[model samples]
Structure formats: structure tokens, C-alpha cells
Target: MKVGLIGFGKTGRAVASVLLESKKVNLQWVLRKSTTLEHRSVPEFLGVHSDEPGLIYSISEFSADELFEKHPVDVIIDFSSADGVDYYAEAATKRGITVISAISAYPDNKLKLLSEIAEKIPVLHSPNITLGINFLMIAAKILKNIAPYTDIEIIEEHFKSKPEVSGTAKKIAQALDLPDESIKTIRAGGIIGVHEIIFGFPYQVVRLRHESISREAFGNGIIFALENLVGKDNGLYTMEDLLLPYFHLNETEQMFIEKNTKPWWRFW
Candidate 1:
């Protein structure tokens, strides 16, 4: 598969490196705003030593009608901002390229755009792209069902510079059907990310947690999405649907998915 990557941040860099190592993927286009002193050249940015000067251009370098005309891609993997998700989704949808997005949280209106794009092409969106974190969510959901009325709270710790509760924790809240205010966030140290859910009952307490040792987990999740995305028809997909095979789901968990899932646009 040919891939055009968006973003060049920590996860984006990780994804680029993994794509270079993949036997099935051709790591092609990467968007750069500028080649000025502020931005590294393609070779330096992607950690490659290519001599070609024609490579690496920002989204502005190509018009929408000319995006695929000059260079083609089978899928677009995005590890950028929410704006990047909408930007690439529009271009990819026009050219029938599958998109796997691991971008940050987006507003409902932007997400609605994603849902519309999914109507014509496969659009896999995940706020938490780490498989372990997603599995943690699945387990947490099961626990939520087992103790439906139990007092539960989630605590997420991230780098002190990070301003909001990490998306993974919010994703956990979604699984547990808890309100946004139910999450407690700790911004301290240089901690990559740590998510733990505490469930308190009159008789006992239960806790489930997952931590990020490295961003390789995110890259692996992206590849997992790529491997499965090809055979799927046009629609939006999430890690919950992607990783269910590895974990055993009880009747309660299965019913929860059936009940909570609906036409995503319907929420708007």
C-alpha cells in the first residue's frame, strides 16, 4: 500500500519510521509547511538520506484537483491535529483513498465531516490509537457493565506541558458512559501518559490501568488499522471494532456496543 502521511510530530515521526520498515507500505508523501529554517528537509524530517530534491512538499504545493494527479496514494495515515484530519479527509475522499486518522480530539462538527467522508470511503478514526489503551477501554467497559451503578472515576497523568486530559482517558470515559467531568487529570513531570480507572463499591474496589512506555504502540495500532482497512467497505471504524478479536467479550460488553453504537452523525 502507498501512504501519504500528515504531521511530523512525535507520533507522526514514529509512524513514518514504521512505514519505512513495513514490507507492504510505500512511504511516499509527507506534508511540510515550509522548507525554511523552521522546518527540517524531507530527508532530515523522515530520517532518510535520499538525494532527490523534488520530494517533500506542503499541502499547498498541490491543488486538490492536482493532488493525486501528480502523485497517487492508496491510503493516508494522519497523526496530526484535528484540523489536519478534516483537511486530509477532504482530499482523500475526493480521490477514493482510505484514511486512518490518529489525530487529537475534534469538535462534533468536524467529526460529522469525517462521518460524511466515511460514507464514500473507509475512514478509520481513533483518538487513542494505542492497542493496549484500547484494550484497557474494553476491559473497563466490561467492568462498568458488571457494576453499572458503581461509583467510578478515571485519573490520567500526562506531561506537565500537556493542557488537557489525554484522549485515551476521555475514550475510557466514553466506554464507561461517564460524563466529561468524571475524569481527573494530572499534568506533571515528563510522564508520557498514564491512565487508570478507579471503581469504588460498598464492598470492594477495582482498578484498571495502562501506561505508554513508547509511541511504538501507536504506530503498531496504525499498521493494524492499515492491514484491516483494505477489505472493509466505506464507513467509519474505530479501535473498539479493530481489536475485539484478541479479547474475549462477555454478553454485557457485546450488548453495550450494540446499544451505544449508532449512525455517528445522528449524535449531531
Candidate 2:
């Protein structure tokens, strides 16, 4: 399928490399305005469809209206910053193009805007997209019941170059009802990403961890989302809902867990 990449930064480059290797994706457009140096130095990459050369263009110079008129992209994966993400989302929705955003926004207000726009078109919004972490969500739900009444703490570590703490950790904390202040963030060299949540009672601590040794771990979830979009239409979806089938919890088991589980809101 034809796809568009909105950012050409490190994560975007990684995503492009994977998509190109899979050979299942046709990257139709790369929207970015590089400095004069980058424009001259950016090399031909794998993600750029071999048949479609020079798809990368500066957004600073290219208007959204011009993009819709000149090119048609089925899905747009936006790894751009919050500054232009909202505008791009609105423009993409108006054009009926499905959009996926890896960009994170603040104070909850931007998220509200994103959700509202997503409802108008097929939008996959996620702070983190690694399938391992999605599985962690399932495990967290399971632990919520079996380990209810236990003290919970989460630790997340990412590469030293990462500008912020792990978004995955924050999401887990939110899901598990752990106070925001209790989640610990660590930065270290060469670590792609790692998140461990521990449940502690009087005598034991149950730890559930998801670790990414490389950036390729993100491919599983990205492909899953893409496949889902191929079959479905417009709506906002998260990795949690995408990975639900793999959970395989029986009704009786679910009920039993529910009986002992603490609601996430109570964690604070």
C-alpha cells in the first residue's frame, strides 16, 4: 500500500528502513524541510520507493493543499513534532487519508484534539508502538487482579540520547493506576528501551518487564496496525485494542480476576 512519512528524524528513519526491508510498503511521500546542508547531504534511503524517487520534500515549502492535489497517499505515519501534528491531522482527515501519529502532546488538551480528529478518519494514535509493550499491557491487566492490594512501582529506561522518559512507562503507570510520581525514569547508554513494573506485597514482588534490544521490535505493532487499517475504515485505535486477541483469557478466569482486582483509578 502507498504510505507517507511525515518526519525524517531518527525514529522515522528507523521505521522507513524496516518498511523498505519488508518490501510490503510503498513510501509515497516524505514531508520534511531540511536545512540547506541536509538537503544536500541526505542520501537515498531504502524506505523511498525505488519506483518513486525524490518523494521527500520540505513541508516548509510544500503546502498541504498542494500535497493532496499532487499526490495521493493511503496512509500517513506522522512522526513529526506537536507543532505541526495537529494541523497535519486536520488536513489529512479532510483529505480522507488515514493517519498514524507517534508524536506525543501535552497537558491532555492536545490529546483531546487528536482524539476528536481521529474519530473523523482512521487514526492510529500511540506514544509507543512496540508489540512487546502491548503484550505488557495484557500482562498488566492480568497482574492487576492476581496481585491486587499489592504495592506497585514501575521503572523505565531508555537510551541516553532520548529527549524524554519512556512514554511506554507513563502509559503503563496510567493503566495500572500507579501515581505518576511513583514511576521512575532512567537514562543509560546503548539501551533502546526497557520497562519493568513490579507488584509488591508482604513477602514477594511480581515483575513484568518488556525490553527492546533494537528498534525493530516496533515493526510488529506497526504492521499489525497497518493490516488492521487495510480491513477497517476510520476510527481511533490503540495498541491495547489491537493486541486483545492474543490475550486468550477465558470468561471464568476473567470473572475471578475481576472479583479480586483493584480498579486502576484507585492506585493513586
Candidate 3:
């Protein structure tokens, strides 16, 4: 797959590093709001060795239409601000490019715009795009479904600089139908990110925790999205949608079940 990236912040740089090292996709270019690294090679900037022409461009210098027309890509992974969608969404949709938005949050209006654009091409918006986090959410939902009365608590920890509650924490709370106040936040030294869901049962306590050690985790999530989102129908999607299919039993599990089961007559 040919991929383009939007945003060049710290997280974006980390994601680019992961993408540049991957063999599954070719990173065509990266678009950022600033011109500080304009026309620089992403690989050279990241000090990696690659020949994919991973260039960087400033939005001020190149319009989205011009960029897409001059350099086409199969998918566009966005790590930019929520408003960054306004810049490339239209052009990308016109070209039928899949959009994978890892933006942490989006206003209602922008979300509506994304829905409209989804009618033309696949659009995936994930507030927390880390694979482990999304898996944690799915597992939490499943546990909630199985044990509806279990007392659940969500705890999110991040770097000391982030004061507000995590958007991902809020998402998990919403998924489990817990009150916002049920979320606990811990701000400490340089903790990349941690979200833990505690399920309080009568006999035991179940904890599902996902910790992001580095921003490159987002790139891994993007790669997972790319592998699944191809050939998907035009629609708005989330990380959950991409992950739910893997929830089924694998071949080994299926074989184990088959081997362990006996006919009802054999029970006699």
C-alpha cells in the first residue's frame, strides 16, 4: 500500500519512523501545518535508511488538491489536529482514498463532515488508535456484556503535563455506560499512556490494562487498520469495527473445542 501521513508532531514523527521501517506500505509523503521541515526527506530526518521517497511538505506551501493530484496514495493516515480533516478530506474523498484518522478528538460538526465524506470512501476515526487500547475496550465491552452487574472502574494515567481526563478513558467509560466521574486520572512523570479497567466481581477482581510504551504504537495500529480497511464499503468506522472480527475463536481454539467435546450419548 502507498500511504501518506498528515501531521509532523512528536507522535507523527514516531509513526513515520515505524512506517518507514515497515515493508507492507510505502510512505509517499507527509503533510504538516508548519514549514520548518518543508521539502525534507522523512527517512533522512528520522535517520533511517529507505528509498521510498518519504518526503515532507507544508500545508501552507501545497494545497491538499495539489498534493493529492501530484502524488497519489492508497491510504491517508492522519495524526494531525481535528481541523486537519478540513484540509485533505475533500480531495482524498474525490480520489477515493481511505482515511484513517487518529485524531484524539473532533467537534460535532467535524464528525458530521466525516460521516458525509464516508459516503464516498472508507473513513475510520479512532480517538485512541493504539491496538492494545482498542483491544482493551473490546474486552471490557465483552466482560460488561457477560457480567452486567459488575462494578467497573476506569483508570487512566498519562504524563504530568496532561491535566484533563483522557479522551480514551471517556470513551471506555461511555462504552461500559459508566458515569464520567467513575474515571480516575493519574498524572505522573512521562508515563507514555496507561488505561486499566477493573471489573469488580463478587469472588474475584478482573483487571484489563493496556499500556502504550511509545508513540510508535499508534503506527502499529495504523498498519492494522490498513490491513483490514482495504476493500471495505464506504462508511464511517472505528477501531472497534476493525477489531471485532478477530474476537472469534481461532483455528487452534476451534480444534481444541472439537477435540474436547463428546457426543451426548458418550456422556452416558
Candidate 4:
């Protein structure tokens, strides 16, 4: 797969580092708002030994149309600001390129625009794209389904600079129909991110937690998304959509159950 990246900030740089090291995908180019590193090779800038032409471009120098024509890629992984979608939506749609937006938040209007573009190609939008976080969400939902009356609480922690509640935590809360008050926030040190969900039953407490030790986790999530998004029908998708198919028991497990377990009526 050939990949294009948007945004070269702290997290973006980390993701680029991971992509440059991967063998499965070729990183064609990266677009950033600043011109400080314009026209530079990403691999050289990051000190990685690769020959993939991982160049960097300033958004101001090249229009989206020109960039897409010059370096067409299989997919565009966006870790840019919420408005970054406006820059590539039309061009990407025209080329039928897959899009994976890891933007933290998007207003209603932009979300509607994403939906509109999804009509032409596969589009995935995720606030928190880390694989562990998405897996945590799926597990939390399953636990909720199993114990509907269990008392649940969501706790999110981030760096001290981030004051607002985490969008991911909110999504987890919404998934379990939890009220805002049920969420607890903690801001400290340089923590990348942490989300923990606690399920309180009559006899025991269950906790599911996902912690990001590094921003490279986002790149791993992008790789996972790319692997699954291929040949998908044109539509809007989330990480949950890509992961749900894997939650079922395998054939061997199912066969074992069938062979070993008797029907409830037989015991009665």
C-alpha cells in the first residue's frame, strides 16, 4: 500500500517514523502546515535508511489537486486538525482513495461532509485511533451487554495541558449509556493518554484499561485499518466496524462447544 500523511506535528512525526520503518506500506509523502521542513525527505529527516521517496510538502505550496495528481496514494491517513478534511476530501474522492481520519474531533458540518464523501469511497473517522483503545471500547460494550445493571464508570487521564474531557472517554460513556457525571478526569505530567472503564457487580469489580506509552501506537492502528479497509464497500466506517467481525468464536471453538456441551433441555 502507498500512503500519504497529513500533519507533521509531534504525533504526526511519530506516526511517520513508524510508517517509514514498516515493510508493508510505502509512505509517498507528508503534508504539513509549516514550511520549515518543506521539500525534505521524511526518511532522511527522521534518520531512517529507506528509499521510498518519503518527501514532505508544505500545504501552502501545493494545492490538494496538484498533490494528488503528482503523488497518488492508496490511502491518506490524517492526524491533522479537524478542518484538515476540507483540504483533501474532494481530491481524494475524485481519485477514489481510502481515507482514515484520526482527527480528535469534528463538528457536525464537517462530519456531514465526511459522510457525503463516503458515498464515493471508504472513509473512516476515529477520534482515538489507537488499537488498544478501540479494543477496550468493544470489550466494554460486551460487558455492558452481559451485565446491563452493573454500575459503570469511565476514567480518562491526559497531559496537564489538556483541560477538556476526552472525546474517546465521551464515546465510551455514550456507548454504555453513561451520564457525564459517571466520567472522572485526571490531568498530570506528560502522559500520552489513558482510559479505564470500571464495571461494578454485586460481588466483584472489573476494570478494562488501555494506556498509550507512545504516539507510535497511532501508526499501528492506521496499519491495522489499512489492512482491513481494502475492498470494502463505499461507506462511512469506524474502528468498531473494522473490528467487530473478529469478535466471534473461531470454527474450532464453535465445534468444540457443539461436541462437548449438551443442550439445556437435555439436562432438564
Candidate 5:
């Protein structure tokens, strides 16, 4: 499969690395202008064709029309900022290309509009795409059933470079019918991502946790989503859709919860 990566940053480079290393994927070329000598060397080592200067998109200034008219990529992976991702994603979907976005912290209007469009095309918009987190989402549902009397509180920690609280916390809060204010985010050094759900009562506290020691674990989930994008029906998909077997949700319940319980959407 020919894949185009937008926003060639750390995550984008990682996605390229994972895809190139995999047998089923082909790194067609990147879309952007300003390539350094170091960036130019990336494609050679990855064993894929690099499109630069001659029909290559290098600059970050991609207008929605330009993105729609010029690019013919099958799948576009967006790891760019939330600034203009909605436009890029909308344009990609209108053109029948599946767009998978991994960025977080965006306005609700964008997400609402994205969901509206997704009913027509396949679009993957996930704040945390790590499969482990998805597993947790499913587990949260189970805990809701098994631990009926427990009160849940979420806490998340991330690296110092991270700008905001954990999206996983926010996602978990939404899944369990908790409010946005009920979730907490922490920023610190040397920590990749950590989320803990504390289920408490009068006498005891049960903690369920998941931590990310490296970015590669997150990339594994991205690759998982990309792998499934092929021939998938049009719809808005979350990490819950990408992860399976770990959770005990049936098809009917999964669809109902995904459609209605998206608390992150409440931000809009």
C-alpha cells in the first residue's frame, strides 16, 4: 500500500520507520517542502522512493484545495498539529482517501465536523491510539459491570515535553460516564505516558493501570490501525475498533457504546 505522511515530525518519522519495516506497506513519499540534508537521507535508508522538488510537497503550508487537487495517495497518515488537520482530513475524505490522524487537543467543532463527514468515509481520529489504552477502554466497561459499587477516578502522567494532560484520561472518563473535570493530567520528565483508574469505596481502592515506556508501543497501535484501513467501511473509528480479544464486548454493545459514549466529543 502506498501511504503519504503529513506533518513529518517525530511521530511521522516513527510511522515511516514502522511502515517501511513492515512487509505489507510501501512508503510512497512524504508531503512537505523544507527538507534538510539529514531529512533527505531518510528515504534511502528506509528503501522507499522520496518525492522532493519534483512533485514533492515539502512546506507545511498545505491549503485544503491544494491537498485535494494535487495528492492521489491511497491512505494519508496525519501526525501534524491540530491547526489545519480538519481541513486536510476533510479534503482527504471527500477524495475517497482514508485519513488516520493521531494528534490531540483540538476544538470540538473539528471533531463534530469530522464525525459528520465520517458517516460518508473512513476516518480514524484517536487521541491515544496505543492498543493497550484501547484494551483499558474495554476493561473499563467490564469493571463497570463487575465492580458495580466502585467510584472511579482517573490520573494521567506524561513527559515534560507534552503540552497537555493525558488524552487517555479524558477518554477513560468519557467511557465511564465521568466528567472532563473528573480526569487529571500530569506533565513530568522521563515519563512517556501513564494512566491509572482508581476504583474506590468506603474501605478499599482497586487500581488498574497502563504505562508507556517507549513510543514504539504507541506506533504498534498506529500500524495496527493502518493495517485494518484497507477495505474498511466508511465510519469514524476509535482505538477500541483497532483493538480486539482483550475486551469482552459483543458487536451490538460495542457499536452502541462507541456511538453514544464518546465523552471526548463533549468537549465540543
Candidate 6:
């Protein structure tokens, strides 16, 4: 499998390290721009940086039209910023390449547009790419069935640098069918990430939580997504699709993803 990566930051670097060490995936062009892969280690290319040596791909720029011609790949993984969302979706759809995106904090409309793009290609986007958190989302749906009337809410905290409410919180809320989620966000000093869900009823309360001690939490999920992306049909997939064997979701979360169908014309 040939793979292309964007975003050489923490999670991106870790995932790249694993893929490189695996010796199975061919690292294709590592594009800085979501668009054009036109140069070869040209140095002036905007966002390409490799602290790790012996990478298989050249650091370069890539346009949507030139992607397959330059760096042909079965899959493209993005841990990039929200700005790369549409460009990745557009580029991948053009060549029928599957994209696993862990990019977050974009507006809902952008996500809706990505869903439309998925009708054209296989696109799986997750805000928190930790299998644990994704399982929590499925768990949230289950707990809702057990305590259907409980008042459930999410509280998430990250480092002071983290700008917005976590995408995981929103995922939890969406899993439980809450359009307006009650999610608390706290940004403190150097904290990695902590997420908790509180379900309160007449008798007692249930608290389910997951904490991230390192970026490996994120890497684990990304690698899992990449591994399962092969031989998948074209559609918008979520972590639930990836977690079917290990964790079986019985209700909303299961029926939701499994039954989702988008119109072919919606891709336009």
C-alpha cells in the first residue's frame, strides 16, 4: 500500500514513524499543500519538514489534478488542520483514494460538505482519533438505552493551547441524539486531554471517562483506520465502522452508520 501524509506535527509524526517502521506501506509524496505535488525536496516548498531520516517520500507541494500522476497511493492520511479538509476530500475523490482524517474544529457545514464528498470516495473523518474515545461514543449510545431518561453531558479538558470544545464531546452528544450538547471545555497548563461523560438519573449517576497520557492514543486510532481502509466500499465511514469486530454497538450508533446512504448526485 502506498500512503501519503500531511501534517508533520505530533500525531502526524508518530503515525508516520509507525508506517515507516512497518516496511509494508510505501510512503508516497508527503505534500505540504493539500493541492499540488510539483517539486522534489525543493526546500522552498511551503510546509514540508522531516526531522526523521530515511523517509520514502519527497517533501513537496501537490495539486488535486496532479496527485495520482505524482504520488499514487491507495490511501491518504491527514492529521492536518481544518484548512485541508475540502482539499483532501476533493483530491482523494478525484482518484478514488480513501482518506482517513483526524482533523477537527471545523464548522458543521464543512463536515456536511465532506459527507457529500464521501458519496464520491471513501472518507472517514474523526475529531478524536482514539479508539477509546470512539468506543465511548458507542458506549454513550448504549448507556442512553439503559437510562433513557438520564441527563447526560460531557466535560473535556485540554492544554491551554487547545482552542475549542473537543470534537469528541460533540461526537458523544451526536451519538446520543442531542443536537445541543452540554459539553464543558477547560484549557489548562500542558494537559494532554481528559474526557468524561456523566449520566444522571433519579437513583444515581454514571460516569464514563477516558484520558490521554500521550499522543500515542491518537496514533493507535489513526493506524487502525489506515489498516482497515483497504478494500472498503466508497462512502462516509466513522470509527464505528472500524470498530465493528472489537466492539459491537447495539443501537443508534450501529444503525446510524450501517444504514447511512447518500445520493449519488449529492457529491456534486
- For all predicted structures, in order, the TM-scores are 0.83, 0.82, 0.94, 0.94, 0.76, 0.75
lDDT of 1 by residue, 79-140 (tens): 76777765566667888999888876889988898999999999899988887888888888
lDDT of 5 by residue, 90-188 (tens): 677678888787876568877787787688788888887778887877887887888778888899988888886676687788889889887877887
262 Cα displacement, candidate 6 (Å) = 45
Position 160, candidate 6: lDDT: 98
Off by over 4 Å in 6: 33-60, 179-181, 248-268
Query: Model 2's lDDT to the true fold?
Result: 0.73
How displaced is residue 183 in candidate 5, in Å?
A: 3.2
lDDT of 1: 0.78
Instruction: State each model's C-alpha RMSD to the native.
Output: 9.2, 7.1, 2.9, 3.0, 9.3, 11.0
- Those runs of model 4 whose alpha carbons end farther than 4 Å from true positions after fitting are 256-268
What is the Å distance of residue 91 in model 6 from its true position? 3.8
What lDDT score is found at residue 70 in candidate 4?
A: 93
lDDT of 2 by residue, 10-124 (tens): 7777776666555576766677767432332122654333554325678876678777668778888877787556557667878888877767544577777777777788778
What lDDT does the true structure give each of the candidates?
A: 0.78, 0.73, 0.93, 0.93, 0.72, 0.72
- lDDT (Cα, tens digit) per residue for candidate 4, span 94-161: 99999999998899999999999999999999998889999999999889998999989999999999
The lDDT of model 6 is 0.72
TM-score of 1: 0.83
Ranking by lDDT: 4, 3, 1, 2, 6, 5
Instruction: Please list all clashing residue pairs in model 4, or write none if there are none.
Output: none
lDDT of 3 by residue, 190-260 (tens): 99899999999999999999999999999899889999999999999999998998888999999999999
The alpha-carbon deviation from the true structure for residue 127 of candidate 5, after best TM-score superposition, in angstroms, is 0.6
Candidate order, TM-score descending:
3, 4, 1, 2, 5, 6
